[model samples]
Target: MDKYDVVVIGGGPGGYVAAIRAAQLGGKVCVIEKGHLGGTCLNRGCIPSKAIITSMKLLSLIKSSSSFGIDVQGYQINFPKVISRKDEVVLKLRQGIGGLFKAKKIDLKNGDYSNRFRAA
Candidate 1:
C-alpha cells in the first residue's frame, strides 16, 4: 500500500488547493475524488452556469444592438451548442487541475478510499 503525508478526501476547490499546498511543502499528497477533479463548482455549478449565462448575455446584447447603431439581422440560440460549450469549458478546467497535480507530483486517485482506521 502506498503511503502519503496528506490524503485529501475531495478534489473540490478547497481540497485540491490544500493538496497542492501539501505537495509544494514537500509532502507526499494524494487526492481521492469520487467525481470530476474540479468538483461541483467547476463541473456543474459555477463554471457551467457562467458559460450559459455568458451566451445568454451575448444574445441579449445582439438583440438590442440596434440601439448601438449596429445592424444585427438574425440571431438564434442553439441549446445543444450552448451545452457543448459548457462541457468543453468544464473539461478544459478539469484538465488544468489534473495538470497541476501532475506537475506538483500529487497523486490523484478516482473513487473512494475505503480503508477505515484500524487499531493495532
Candidate 2:
C-alpha cells in the first residue's frame, strides 16, 4: 500500500495548493482527483471562463478601436475557433499543473478513493 503524509481528496485550487505546500515542507503528498485536475476552476468555471472572457474583451477592444483612430475592416468572430482556443488554453493549464505535480514528486490518483482512503 502507498503511504502519504498528506492526502488531498480533491484536485481543485485549494486542494492542489495544499498538497504542494505540504510536499515543500518535506511530506509525502498524494492527490486523489475523481475528475480532471483543477476541478471546476480550470475545467469549467474559472480558467475556461476566463479564457472566453479574454477573447470577448479582445473583440470588444477591436470593435471600439475605430474611435481611437484605428480603422477596422470586415471582421467577424469565428466561434468555432474561439471555442477551440478556449479548449486549448484549458488543456495547456491542466497539463502544466500535472507537470508541477510530477516535478514535486506528488502522487496523483484519478479515481474515487472515498471508501478506500486512509491517512498513512
Of the candidates shown, which would achieve the greatest lDDT relative to the real structure? 1
TM-score of 1: 0.94
How well does each candidate superpose onto the true structure, as a TM-score?
Answer: 0.94, 0.91
- Model 1 misplaced stretches (Cα beyond 4 Å): 115-120
Backbone clash tally (model 1): 0
- Give lDDT tens digits, candidate 1, residues 33-99: 9888998999989999999999999999999899999988857889999999999999999999999
**TM-score between candidate 2 and the true structure:** 0.91
- Point to the candidate with the largest TM-score: 1
- Candidate 2 lowest-lDDT run of ten: 111-120
Per-model CA lDDT versus the true structure: 0.92, 0.91
State in Å the error of residue 83, model 1. 0.8
Q: Write the per-residue lDDT of candidate 2 for residues 1-120, one digit (tens) a residue.
A: 887788899999999999889989999999999999989989999888888999899999999999999988998999999899999999999998898899899999998878995444
